[model samples]
Target: MSLRDRLKETRAKASDGFRGGKLMSSIFRPGSPFRKGYVDSPRNRSYVVMNNVLYHLHPVKVKRHGVRLSYTLCLGGLSFFLFIVLTITGIWLMFYFRPTELAYVDIQNLQTTIAFGSLVRNMHRWGAHLMVLVVFLHMSRVFYHGAYKAPREFNWVIGVILLLLTLLLSFTGYLLPWDQLAIWAVTVGGNMAGYVPVVGAQVKFGLFAGLEATTATLLRFYVLHVLFFPFIIVIFMAVHFWRVRKDGGISGPL
Candidate 1:
């Protein structure tokens, strides 16, 4: 065949292959693993939500009043967002931190010498405080709106547990810096734990692992901060969200 005729045949084959692929893709529904389609219709949108791991957390149908910004205020969502921010920044900060006497020096170097280290540390610190505040406010909002009534009562209890977990996460992270401020603050907090009736002293002893904040205390707090408490918090948070769906989505007017 002539070179021009050969080139023409090759182009035709390529075009045919492309058309065949397109036709195969068109056969599957939108959001199929093979091809994602535009969500132009209600059914397609529902399919998208149902198919997505994250969006499936939401109910297929929502009440008109349940979505009002003024009523819900999105506090619960913002609290969860801040927790995610803390988790990211905390993981980054963990790379440079040590649970020993060098921890303070490492933090100082992280803030002054490392690139964007200070930003990440500050974000984790502030995000921890903000998560506590937002979770508390979310609980208050739920209580004031009487959203805790009926089937949601257990979810409300779950929310309270989450709030406590938020506080514990912050408290455990507080000792990681190993500075004078962290030491004294944790000392005071531990003393409060000592005020409990029977297990008070035992709790304090377990917290410090000694009479004072030593290497043992630091390591214990580090393990809890990095591993134990976060795992628990995530598990409970998942349960809390699932219960929100089971209890009929976000609370609304009666």
Candidate 2:
């Protein structure tokens, strides 16, 4: 057997012999020194993973210098980091902004009133665009790497759903400014939804909450942008992260 396999066997045997409450304590305690630096420690094992069945998801020993640049650059982590940046900047902008009839003028005043508000807004806007582009590229990388095979297929589907949700989030947020571009963009988007054959009109009405782009439409988009999609995206992201572990730690090229 390999040295690492033998070592894991020895550790398992040793851990299995611990008696009393001490056994369970050591098994469950993440900070237990006995478990630290050991590969088979319960805290370090894949037992907690809920998706798929692949257990060799983590390296027994990861080399610090072996990580590939393409994986780091094109993986979804960069997109996530950009999303975080946008979230922080969006929150900051919210302090001096409102999402109503004067939203556009308020945005204009923010550019002039709040210190660095214009920079913050620009960062938020550009970061959002970059995030969308990065997410699409990340999915492409995953696909090209054959990372979505077997146990990872479900996670791949989830990733696709997350991508769609991310696009929806960006679209909804576009309307909160109440600008001409925002209005027409949403109007065109709603009209597209309205072209859903027999249910097109109903779909459009549901999205706008009326026959026209009234206060209800703005309020609906505002709530969706600020609340609903964020919560759903965060949940799916959590699932995605967990699935990464379950799918054998981001599949390598065949």
Candidate 3:
């Protein structure tokens, strides 16, 4: 046989060796999709989806239009990817940050003293900004495509909640730098919150903890930025994803 044929034969033999081995069988039960497209029946589909978390995130079958990049632009995926990037970069940044009266000093040190600290901090900051924009675009795409209608309405609501939570997460993180701009932004945001009707004063007080921004306000925002908001957003994102799958996988072009 020719060299090409020999290489193909060798590849086939190696594939078969694993494909027919006990390890493969142990990892993928009979009729598993991982086993040569065995998920051709309802029973196999259910079994594979139950066993595989990757399959659980996506539909067993998708329409040709639904898989088109032009139609969806993969905005949701991009948004999720940015969030993960932020999470990782944010964790790395936490080691150098101190959310106290010395917060600005810590930020200065982070940008100058540590290795790649400037790069990581910029990634965290820009990643947050990108996530917010991408999420908004994702929502807009859903609306333009009319994917927000009918059975997916509830998921749409969940998406809106996630958006709000994302914005709040960004806002909370904004104050961690503790510069003049951050303080001024907090004052403006607090003032804006005070316009809310019944609980306006209480809301403003809770936000800043007093008449003006203080170290306590920084601490509160830090806790919310690093802990509270992330926890809440993660829960909502899970529910949003589950509801999307239940609502009929990804919506196809109309």
Candidate 4:
């Protein structure tokens, strides 16, 4: 065959092979359209909502009042957003943080020597504070609206756990700098835990790994701050969102 005809024949064969492939067949089944091809249409929209991991958390319909900014103030959403910001900034800060006696010097160097280090550190710090405040406000909003009744009672418990986790996350992170402020603050906090009736002393000992804030205490707090509590928060946050939908979207007028 001539070169042009030969090229056409090869192209036709390749096209046929692709059409017969199982991978392509599985992706674009005979009856189903391409996943992206479905948009705006009612069926496709429903499919998207049901199939998508994130979208599945939301109900098909939400109460008008439930979404009103004046009613909800969007505190829960803002808290989650600030959490994302803190996570991103925290990861960036981790590159420069040492979590040891040198941790304070490391932070100082991070602010002075590293590019944009001060900005990232400050964002993480402020984001953490904002998250705690927003989460507290969210709980208050839910409470005042009487959304914690009946079916939502369990979810309210989940929110309370999330609130505690938020506080714990902030507290654990506070000790990472290993400065005099961190040391004394943690020491005072540990002492307060010592006021708990039976387990107080044990809690205090576990907190500092001794009577004082030692290297072990720093490492323990670092692990909980960077790894443990964040993991638990993510899991509980998922449950919290899912329960919101399960309990009939955001609480609103009966």
Candidate 5:
């Protein structure tokens, strides 16, 4: 037998299930419209076919009606918009401010000397606040809707973790300005860490790097706020959204 013929015979003999069994794999029917050639149009029908064939990660049919503006607008879309705004404004603010003892001084200089710098800082601050609010609302909406059921329970757990991370992100940023508000907020927050059982002292020491919120504390929080949290949140958010799509789109109230 030829090499190609031998290979085909080997595959045919191996297992019937190898053809994609009924019990396994959500297989689309061969020659169905979904599997057929695309409709030819003037603009890029070939490209559409290519994309559909190449990227089959997303489901062929999303429940378009199930995805409502009322459910998604403030919860998902607004929060994502605020995240984008924070990322842009934060990067712009970075050009002028150093994450050092001079950090507060740089901010002061920006407010007094730099054009529209105060506005930039205010927008970042307010956006941070709004992100928190919207995230909380999102969580509540998901919870009330019973979206945590069955296959989506794990993703709901991830969403809860992301919520905590958002709060941590806000708390870390709170210390960056080094104003009285920032100082006292970190002090109180650090003290709360010390209130935890068993390894509380260790956690508090690690957070503050000794007795007080020193230069070390400022630098730690800065690194976390600007660098660490953003990276972590981005990854988690991507997973969260993917899982949403996977769990058959966002759930409606039970």
Candidate 6:
């Protein structure tokens, strides 16, 4: 057997007979990162990174270039942070919102009556816009950095799916106010969807819930904005992060 394999066997035998036997071996497993500076060697370093709970999201022993501040310009991290902010602010806005025709009145009350309501609403609105930009920029950074090559190709597709979901979220929320502006904007958007070849009519109908936008459309968009889209985006985000770690962490600098 290889030296490393033999070493593993010896460690197992030793652990099987130690004071706490298997319990100690389980917690302190060979090369447990909790034992800091344990032997400073390649094998130990790899084991440390592999066994550390905190490394689940990002393996610390990454390439030298991946550590540079300018390498990614923090776009990916910022995009994720903005998503979290949007989620928090979105939830806060939800408590005061209604998807019916009274939605506009509810919005006005939020802005004029509820304490910090205007602030939170504005934060949610602007945060959504910023998240769209940030996610796009993050994708652009990945593309230019060649991080989308090879095994990361699937992640690139996931990122694109996320960006599209972000756009849909933003569009759906735009109608939550139930104002004339929202109506006109969505009408124009739906009309555009109606030109999409074979599924055009169905797409537009599905979007606005009838021949045109209505109270039903408002409720439909509301559910999609507040529930469906968010749930779908989150699932994609999890897989994207998992692929990042599995594909040997982030790619090195170009």
Candidate 5 collision pairs: none
Q: Residue-wise lDDT of candidate 4 within 146-228, one digit each (tens)?
A: 99998999999999999999999999898887888988888888899999999988989998888889978998999999999
Quantify all predictions' global Cα lDDT against the true fold: 0.85, 0.77, 0.88, 0.85, 0.80, 0.86
In candidate 6, what are the lDDT values of residues 189-241, reduced to their tens digit? Answer: 88999999999999999998999999999999999999999999999999988
Candidate maximizing lDDT: 3
Q: What's model 3's TM-score? A: 0.83
User: Model 5, 53-125: lDDT tens per residue?
Assistant: 4334344444664556776564776787799999999998888988778988999998999989999999999
Tens digits of per-residue lDDT, candidate 2, 1-254, equal 99999999998777655522465555544433344233555555433332213322344443343266756564587887887898899888878767677788888988898889889989988888788888999898888878788889999999999899889988988887788898899998988998899998999999998987766788898788878998899999889888887666757645
lDDT of 1 at 134: 91
Global Cα lDDT for candidate 5:
0.80
Off by over 4 Å in 3: 1-51
- Per-residue CA lDDT of model 3 for 36-90, tens digit only, reads 4463788886677667756667766777888888988999989888989999999
Please, what is the TM-score per model?
0.86, 0.74, 0.83, 0.81, 0.75, 0.78
The weakest ten consecutive residues by lDDT in model 2 span 48-57
Measured on C-alpha atoms, candidate 4 has an lDDT of: 0.85
TM-score of 5: 0.75
Judging by TM-score against the true structure, name the best candidate: 1
> What's the CA error at residue 89 for candidate 1, in Å?
0.9
**lDDT: which is higher, 2 or 4?**
4
